[model samples]
Target: MHSPEIDNMAKLWDLIGDIRLAMFTTRHHNGHLHSRPMTTQNSRADHDTKLWFFMSRHGSPVAELTGEASVNVAYANPGKDTYVSVSGNATVVDDVAKKRQLWSKSAEAWFPGGPTDPDLALVRVDITHAHFWDVHENKLVQLFEMGKAAVTGHPAPKLGRQGEVRMA
Candidate 1:
């Protein structure tokens, strides 16, 4: 990746690092979309577009993706006013290395047998593009900008940044 692309990917992580949970959405065979909150298994420092999550082997998400691989993962931080949407292809991964690598005690709540649990499966989403809105300003600054825009009858100043990242 070029410096600019690296920078953009880093920025994408910055917007999502503080948000641990993502609304992982998948399309069912019935043509309806379903979403569930899933915890990200990697940190921002990973610096990769691929995301991982642990799920039951027979879970609805696994079944849904087995039929349809396209998926979306959404991150939102209302307190920070940051939001991100990632589109990608997801699949039920069968990598024992990855399972042991990401395994933790917290996950035992769902997988009592730990990494060797037959019901445990890893879902990997290879992101194709990501759209993010990062508004890092404080409430005071945002209100001031909105006030100025209102007074001048002009659009509010976009103190933050928004853009798309194409990883594939």
Candidate 2:
């Protein structure tokens, strides 16, 4: 469980845990942002404030991050009105042990040769900052708030809790 006073990374983990797919964005050589869906591998954020993903050694994500480490990963749970965006530096790790630790049978679908697959790449994103919005209120209440704000000509009322975490 996560509490208000819990470590921000843990709070981030709470928002994203069940939202398994994230739009992992990275910069391309031409300076445009590129994004692709990647599976979230961990059940919780570790104290080190890192997020992990497995990629193919031949994949663009591995090559792009190698050339430019900056990246953003976005997770959204529309049903829960929870969204999280993480900004970080990414590096392709060469640790076999770490790869083995994070590996799963599902991953074999991508890297058919298992953990020892020569094409399997382990990526570690060292979180520098994160922002999240979690709306616990029901849709009816949210609609009412927006309506009231529009009638009053004021900014939309805050829909729910918003927070930022800086780890760098």
Error of 2 at 56 (Å): 1.0
Name the runs in model 2 displaced over 4 angstroms: 1-6, 44-48
| Model 2 clashing residue pairs (backbone) | none
Question: Which residue pairs show collisions in model 1?
Answer: none
Candidate 2 lDDT over 87-116, as tens digits, reads 999998888988887888889899999888
Best by lDDT: 1
Cα deviation in Å at residue 74, candidate 1? 0.6
Q: Write the per-residue lDDT of candidate 1 for residues 29-141, one digit (tens) a residue.
A: 88999999998887544558788899998889999998899999999998988899999999888898888888877889989998889999899999888998878899999
- What TM-score would every model get versus the actual structure? 0.88, 0.90
Number of clashing residue pairs, candidate 2: 0
Using TM-score, give the best candidate's number: 2
